[model samples]
Target: MLDIGIIGASGYTGGELMRLLLSHPQARVELATSRRLMGQKVSATHTHLKDMVDIQFENPDPHEIKDRCDVVFVAVPHGTAMNIVPKILDDKVKVIDLSADYRLKPAVFEDVYGIKHLDPRNVVYGMPELHPEIKHEGFIANPGCFPTGATLAAAPLAQASMIDSVVFDSKTGVSGAGIEPSQASHYPNMAENVQPYKLTKHRHLPEFTQELQRLDKNLTNISFTPHIIPSVRGILTTAHIFTKGTLTKYDVMDLYTEMYQDKPFVRMMDGIPSLSAVKGSNFCDIGFEVDPRNNRVVVISAIDNLVKGASGQAIQNMNIMCGLDETTGLWVPGIAP
Candidate 1:
């Protein structure tokens, strides 16, 4: 079994990593680090994983972490990862950062997130379905939750260069914000209502731009708007993909199916995808329809923002980096109610 460490293991994504990796057949949790929750049992911070793991939260020392773990997942915020990752990264240990630090180029990252890169370097964008060659790399930058769902929803169309303008409207759960309590995440503010934040821009905007531009350089018409719903987990992205010419529903379905046929985690839905259908699982359920009158093909993609969107996808990246089955710890069906 491979020994793994999770830095910043007190937040939603970190707790999720603890939950998923505790059961991973080939990976064992060796260390779970949190600067604030030091010495506390990991399960104490993540009550949901109370009986699932036995590690305590320790303050991170990059050198010690490198010596202890075969692989490490950095679950800290965007700016926080650059501090830890720059210290421990080398060929002796593999790193997967679930942060935006390494997802975009220095200029673009600084422009979007309004921050400077202290230790910028190239790392594979960890979306195994889109870029399975992630298997060949030692370090990976996990895509943002919003970008993962939105990109998968519209990538096929972008690649075919059949699009004119693409507008992505995504509804995400509160958990996507993180484990920290926030004025935005306040129960009364979020309950029985939907609030749309980042109307024209979000930090995840650059990720979609980088990935899609790889397929078609001239495709500049990408727009994303995100909303927060009252739910605890999941992101549903409705991509209003306008094509250069009219295409039938059958044609678009074939395109997505052909692209994702061999990808295990991306499930092509026969009908519209439901949030409940993909909740608590590492599946991205994609369903679409063609509105011939307006030349609009509405594609809906759903995923548990904490699963396929974050921790589960992180584990998927580790699986690829270690030359294991991409779905090793994450092939189970969703916990549909």
Candidate 2:
């Protein structure tokens, strides 16, 4: 069994990783690190894993972590993973970073995040559907939650060179904001309201654009706007893909089917996908409609922001890198009511 270590284990993503890894037959949670929560039980912050995880939070140096874990998941904040990753990543240890640290080019990451990238290296972008090369690597940069849903929603058309321009309007749960309580995540403000922030220049926009552009170099017009919904855990993205030509629904469906045929986590739906269909699961449910008159295709995708978007995707990368079935611990139904 693979010995797993999770850095920044006090946050939502780290907790979610522990929750999912609990069921993996080939993996075990060997270490869970949280500086402040050191010596405390992991179940304290992650109440959902109360009876499931019996491990205590420990804050060992990054160097020591590399010795203990066969695989390490860096689930820290945006700029923090760079620090821990450089210390823990070695030939013996594979790393999957759940941060924005290594997803983009060093220059692009610096420009978008407005922080100097301390450690920059080329690593496979962790969208297994797009980058099959991840299976050959020891390091992976897990895509941002918004980009996970938005990019998957429109990737097939982009690969077919059918997109002229695309606009992604994504609704995400408060959990995407992180476990920390903020003015935006404040119960009163978030309840019975929808707050749209970073209208045109959200940071995740670059990631979505970068992934889609890789499919078709000439495809350039990509815009993304993210909103925080009143829900607790899921991202529902609506993509308005203005195509270069008029296509029927069957034509679009064919593209999605061909692209996602071998992908176990992507579910193509006949009707629009809903958050309930993907909540609490690693699946990304996608569906689209054709607007022939306007030469447009409206696509929608749903994913658990914390699952397919973050921790779950990190684990998916692990399975691929380890040569295990990609769905080893992740092939389960969503908690739809």
TM-score of 2: 0.99
* Highest TM-score model number: 2
- The global C-alpha lDDT for each of the candidates, from Candidate 1 onward, is 0.89, 0.93
Whose lDDT is greatest here? 2
Give the TM-score (vs. native) of candidate 1. 0.98
lDDT of 1 by residue, 35-115 (tens): 888988988878888777877889867789999999999988889888888788889899989989999997888888888
Cα-based lDDT at residue 95, candidate 1: 92
Candidate 1 regions exceeding 4 Å error are: none
Please give the range of 10 consecutive residues that has the lowest summed lDDT in model 2.
81-90
Q: Estimate each model's TM-score.
A: 0.98, 0.99
- Pairs of colliding residues, candidate 2: none
Give me the overall lDDT of model 2.
0.93
Tens-digit per-residue lDDT, 194-215, candidate 2: 9999899999988988999999
